[model samples]
Target: MDAPYGQLIEAEPGVARLLAPNPTPYTFTGTQVHLVGRDELAVIDPGPADAAHIDALVRAIGGRPVAAILVTHTHKDHSPGARPLSATTGAPVVGCAPLVIEGGTEAGFDHLYAPDRVLADGESVVVDSRTLTAVHTPGHTSNHLCFADEAAGILFSGDHVMGWSTSVVIPPDGDMGDYVRSLEKLRGRTQDRIYYPAHGEPVAEPQRLVRGMIGHRLQRERQILRRVEAGDRTVERIVAAAYPGLDPRLVPAAGASVLAHLLELAKRGLVSHADEQWSATA
Candidate 1:
């Protein structure tokens, strides 16, 4: 599965991956577009709207008729190539419901995804032999979805849950409460043993990783509470206190995460948030 455009990981039956050539600080090893099926295929998350990557994707399909275009979310590195690829392969674009920004969206979110068929949670689509059941795990964004292969017990966990870095909780487009709750949602489902993430390598212990993610969020909440109680009012100060030695590049993301936690805490009556600041509910 050697690809000249991007690297290819060893895939199992009915699945192959083509990493997009758009590697950056955000996208660890470039965005991975998964090709699922035997002869005919379903291409998922066709990376950035780059011609080379699209050509690579079409080439990888190797004359196989593409039946479906599945996208997990609408990040710039994830779904921008859907339309062009659709034109090339004539496969209908289908994945998570279109972008619905709640509070606000970050700089890099792809808002142009037009799905031919809107999919909901538990809605399943069969492309060749693979039947991917959409699992609405909205946290990274309002419409993030994770597709599951129920029979094989494998999950295509998008940026909602990744193996490389903890998914950034960018509010108000991203919600910590929803993110934490989604982590809890996956924690109980012990059926999925492996997860194929969009950016990094595949994870074998999805349950353990998900459980750890849940615990990490809760622990982060506690740390944020402690920081707020210790007289850190602003999100920046709280983030500094909560993440003492965080990488400078990730400080902004950490601040957003802390803000999301504070907002969620305010909603739960555990903290008071007002005027661009947060405080302990004394």
Candidate 2:
């Protein structure tokens, strides 16, 4: 995905996006911080605390009054920049309530966010001419949200769904059960025509991708179940069986994802874990 960072890339009539310069293997060409309203601009996912990114956002607005600074969730890559941007523009940061998540060890999660106005599910806020509704879709994290612009038929599907790659569902903060339910919720909603995902290109057929994502997750679960039934119970072994020739750099994440699925399956009484080994329940 090409991110025209310094200038505003017009996505549609009222929507424009600024790319943050903090791209990574996970972030995928930096975070696509969006300017939602044409006149009374609403900044969404300020994208890290880098001065340059925030300055670029301010520049793109071109002295427009920022109605609100909205956040999709409190990940370091998503919410850390909101405070600095708000301080610069005097726009109150509003979105999901902060929920502390235990990141275990490597690649920690952010819990230092507090929104000025907490938005509940089905809550709508009119900024400029657009009505952005909050969709409480928790999966990637306990407080993950996807904002839906009904009039434009575009949904800002945070990290919950992406066009570039499947979202990584790690345990502790991430839940497979909630992820599946959230995908179902999006599939049922007809208001969204395109998904402007945080880290990738716009998803034109969101429902089709949602179905495929659901199937992919379930199939992975089945593979884990099969591995467990075949006497491979630990996360590492399951990851090895499910994702052969996996990149060494991604092993930790793969293990976390398998653990999340195992935990979910265990919660549903479909599997059991004891003495560090898992088994399919009869």
Candidate 3:
């Protein structure tokens, strides 16, 4: 936030970030492009395919060799620049499996994302002096990933865990159960001291924040259940009851999250739906 757009500002000894100018209600200030090495860098989350943003990224590179362009997921705001940036720097695009969910384009997914090499869970790519291991976290999207520099105790937590707001789990491709499980996965990583999320500032106390996030999600689940108990059957009614006075622009996303919760509840047999109406199960 302190750093202006398009400038690479160092966060730690070797970690730096460049903020893209694509801010929105969902994207926070912008999509943060993290550079993971001092010399031969691994660019994480190249952001939108804006010509200006790509040029800014190239300028930030400053002729240094880019080992790889790592994308956390194929969200339009997060991965569209990878192709153009890779073409410009000769760096191979990597990380996260390719996914194209129909009817998801309007929801911000970039269906055209094609990684040069898909890094499986726990698979790693070595940069100049850093090794970033891909942690498959399927919540924000089915292919979302968080890169971990274990030696440095730094995690580039993409949309999975951000400081600004809880990730909106759109159903079908996004799962609430998987989102909670992913939060639990991060919570168990005791060694990850700091987290550089795709939005907001760095998380200095990742574990503490992660624990709180887990509790927040659980509380949301309870709220949804309460709404259902109170005769809020459809996702629209549940959202209206659970998130009163929400911004009209964000209502659709909120409805999506509510549906994700209801789907998860249905999976656990705590709720059941018939003809678009949901009810608490025995």
Candidate 4:
């Protein structure tokens, strides 16, 4: 049966998983997480504020004590339900601070999160017999976090990593440099064999997936540079040329990705910008 968000694909025993009903240009899929253990189970990324979805999650957990509600970031589709769920279950909400972009408002973050527990990089939350370690992998959003479960050997990688699509790097909320670094950090980790991303199925070979993501970004950057060499100076023009066949609806997102790449390229001195136009510098 198909849910409103996307098809549900169960991964790893003891974990109740469901996809949200709403899929959009922005949210490829919605993920509901339920972690069951002895003392008190927890839910991560409880999905949107939909009552039915939240109800489905509550039903799935079946009166099991909800230990905590964890959020990866403050994106609307991801964190808006934390307050209601916390109130319903009396579970403490936990997450990093909402990402604040310089000279810009907190676009989609939830100021209402008011996490009872705030996670730090490398911090771990012990539930029953499992340990969920928080890895601050900022890139998709500055406050993003990935939870590594030592016992399950899995990583609940919010938007930091995905099985089907590349994560968007929209600045000033996103940074390509930080994204690449976060990918590299994941590559260096030794424990995780499977990645339960915020969207799509569980990734069995995370190292391979990480390498592919890094390579794809690099390739896209090269294409953008080539576009610059061919006289497409503005981000809009470059994105049009490089992503010629992308859905029109996705062009705006593509522009954001191009902007992120351009920003990173500028930092490396490979490209320079003047008058809002990018040019190859080397």
Candidate 5:
């Protein structure tokens, strides 16, 4: 998807997006700041605290009364601009709970994200007469949320379900089991017709993609179990074996993901790690 940076492109009726110029391997074509509703807008995932991006958002809003500034998570790339945008438009910042996991700051978390209101799972916030329900789809982060506008059959899926790539689950806060369960939760909701992820193109067939994501995670679980059984007894070794010839820049993240999987497997008694060395238990 050739997302033009700083341009407000209409995704669907009453839904438009402006791409933030913060693209990277993890962020794909940068974070997509979604504007929902027509006259009264609700900004979702305001991206990084980039002055230019915030200026672009204010321009796109065009002095319209903003109902809310909704955030999916507290990731630095997804929520830092909420405060500035809210201040500019006088809209309340609301959505996912604020989180700052100790020792997890280096993971790109926005420690200063102080939401005006935290929406719990299944809770709906009315914006411009449209009810946007918050689905607490954790695992990408413990406080990650996916907002659903049931009336429009549109889901603003955050990093939980991205079209570009599977979400990386780093342990201590990120859990593979919870991530898979969240995927299943979305799969069960056949109502969401389209999903607009924060980082990539919209998913028209969210169910299919979600099912595939579940399968992929489970497949990775099996592969990791096999690797442990075969004496690939460390996260580094498991990452080397599972993600062969992976980019050097992403190796650390890959190792974290492997540890997450191993931790989940240990919970199920399928694998065990002692002294930082993993081994199959079953």
Candidate 6:
């Protein structure tokens, strides 16, 4: 099957895809947004720092003034080009502070993104007649946000939600506790008819998909608990047993998920971790 990005499907009446390049492993999918209603346009999650991708965005906008460049998070694949693109278009880049790198790791290129505007939850930005409200939904990363276009009833879901695979819950930055809460928050929201995720095709059934994601995570947590009860005394062993069918290439990512669950369970005193191993405590 063809990759979802580059497949231009109408998101709403005036919005059209200047599609992101598919197969770019990090972004894997890309989307350059165009808004038709208000003459004013905004590009969300400009994929990567690729020169060609930025050029494609410029061509798609056709000299239309880009009002603002909005970002959901500061992951390398998502926000590295914000500064350059903002310089080209004179649009103020807006988002959470660039992610901080710690303990000898370089700051993932995202640290260079100095957003001119910092968006908070419930804050709204109006471009022409369309109003995009920021919803602080942190999970995939501690700094993720989703924008809801009130006029279009569409949610521009960055990695917070995706149409393809479930997002990773990597630690020290990604939190499963917050991830679950964010999913529940979306479940109670009212104005989302379509979801334009940072990856994969647009999702039509937002509520249903959110429910499925929530259920899947809960099931995984239970599976981990079962493994702990069955004499698995380490995250590695528990992950191997619980996620038996996961691709070998994805084991590292799966291990992170298991770590997140273990951390959450430890916080609740339902499990304990000692000397690099896990065990049921309650």
lDDT of each: 0.84, 0.87, 0.92, 0.81, 0.91, 0.77
Write the residue-wise lDDT of candidate 1 on 191-250 in tens digits: 997888897878899888888888888999998888888889899888777788988988
Model 5 lDDT on a 0 to 1 scale: 0.91
Kindly list the per-residue Cα lDDT of model 2 for residues 1-282, writing each as its tens digit. Answer: 556666778888888888898877778888888889877989889889998888888889899999999999888899999888888899999888787655443255555677899899999788997899999999888888889998788999999998798888877878989999999999998778999998888899998999999999999888888898998979888888888898787788788899999999899998998898888896
Tell me the deviation in Å of residue 123 in model 1: 0.6
The whole-model C-alpha lDDT of candidate 3 against the native structure comes to 0.92
Local error of candidate 3 at 193, Å?
Answer: 0.6
Better of 2 and 5 by TM-score: 5
Q: What is the C-alpha RMSD of each candidate to the true structure, in Å?
A: 2.0, 1.7, 1.3, 2.1, 1.2, 2.3
Candidate 3 weakest lDDT stretch, 10 residues: 100-109
TM-scores for the candidates? 0.95, 0.95, 0.97, 0.93, 0.97, 0.91
Superposition error at 132 for model 1 (Å) = 0.9
Which pairs of residues collide in model 3? none
- List candidate 1 segments past 4 Å from native: 1-5, 102-106
Lowest summed lDDT over 10 consecutive residues: which window, candidate 1?
1-10
Point out where model 6 deviates above 4 Å: 1-9, 22-38, 101-109
Off by over 4 Å in 2: 102-107
Any runs in candidate 4 off by more than 4 Å, and if so which? 1-10, 36-39
Cα misplacement distance, residue 176 of candidate 5 (Å) = 0.8
Q: Model 6: which ten-residue window has the lowest total lDDT?
A: 29-38
Q: Candidate 3 regions off by >4 Å?
A: 102-107
Model 5 pairs whose backbones collide:
none
Candidate with better lDDT, 1 vs 3: 3
Residue 200 error, candidate 3, Å: 0.6
